[model samples]
Target: MITNFLHDNYKNITRVSILDAKKVFYPMKYVLEKRDILIDDDSALIILPFPEDIKYPSNTKMTDAGMLWDYKVEISINNQSALTENQLMRFLNKKVIVVFHHNDGKIIFGCNEMPLQYGYSEDNSVNPAAHCGYSVECRGNSYYSKVST
Candidate 1:
């Protein structure tokens, strides 16, 4: 099971921190491999692989590879320039879901709700991963957007 593997392998190693609310961290190791899948203009369906050295809280258990609980994300984008000084700030108000996928399937991390955004910044630096050329897909949505760090 995922929990068992995480506990036995990454229980004591691997750490992540979000420097900015607009950005999501994608480990450097997977950056190159992730580039190809994310660069497509089409809404790409790709699995997010987690490093074996990362572990979830013991209390949080996964019945399958695609199930995760207690992780929540919110993303907001501004369609109008006058509403917010920074376009990325719009994402602050939107609900977001960080999905993790593996060989099995996709799992929603945090909350399973759709997020709201008023506008989106043309600036790619808003999302670090996207700055590196990775595209992000909203779960279950046909839209494909770029994430700029």
Candidate 2:
């Protein structure tokens, strides 16, 4: 249900843009991957591989109060894009606002806590159409609702 909730909520996001310290625009592509969802009872909990021995307590009450769900979004840079990998890293590593836009609405995912870092991909020197990618972890307390156009 969590994965479906994320996909249904964000699947419409068609664009990702960042505003740097100098207010420069750097648009990037988001390479789709099966989104990783981790449910935690605490807001400060870091997600880890689910433990096999862990069992859900039957008497547990459901509340969104301190619940936190982390979604790992993988963004990419297309070779044909106007921006380069170097250019992206320069501003992305610093404080910035990452905006996700869809046809109906948008979400301003605050990057103040989630700092983007460089990641590796297979060499595409031989291939003419390969994309470079980076990982970004976005945290949210409540599920997003789809807005009406």
Candidate 3:
């Protein structure tokens, strides 16, 4: 079975919408980072049935009995000359529903339920024109499905 769903479709995402507003379209050169964690699984081990006549080693089975569907996502921003540090501070701290849209599907996730915070880029000294650069982390249910384009 092919379980690597996110790997096969990450690039299809074309936009990200925060609630009903704040849409960030794709192909933006300023996207510093993007990632998704899918299929976080935990399984139980079961002893396998063995033949009496054959002297075979004991075998075990892996069961997807307690699989966890908790998904996580991270998005980083960079080089936003139009946004100021103060503005970014306000935006990053709010709780909002984030919608990721792809050519073949979409996923909506929650952020800031525990409060979202933004961090400065590692190399912050080079750009001094209030070039907006920050990172956001989000977590949500892992259940997602593709839709017709």
How large is the C-alpha RMSD of every model relative to the true structure? 14.9, 14.2, 18.8
For all predicted structures, in order, the TM-scores are: 0.24, 0.39, 0.40
Please write out the lDDT profile of model 3 over residues 1-149, one tens digit for every residue: 00223643455555544431122222111111223312111211111111221111112233343222344445555534544444444445444344455555544443222211222332254666743444444443322222211
Candidate 3: C-alpha lDDT = 0.34
Q: What TM-score, to 2 decimals, does candidate 1 have?
A: 0.24
Candidate achieving higher lDDT, 1 or 3: 3
Clashing pairs in 3: none
State the lDDT of candidate 1 residue by residue for 1-149, as single tens digits. 11112323332323221122124333322322222112221221222223542233323334433223332222222223443334234333344433433433332232222221222234345575542222222222111112222
Top-TM-score candidate index? 3
Q: Which 10-residue span in candidate 3 carries the lowest summed lDDT?
A: 40-49
Better of 1 and 2 by TM-score: 2
Scanning candidate 2 in windows of ten residues, the lowest lDDT window is 49-58
Off by over 4 Å in 1: 1-69, 72-90, 110-149
- Candidate 3, position 144, lDDT: 21
| Clash pairs detected, candidate 2 | none
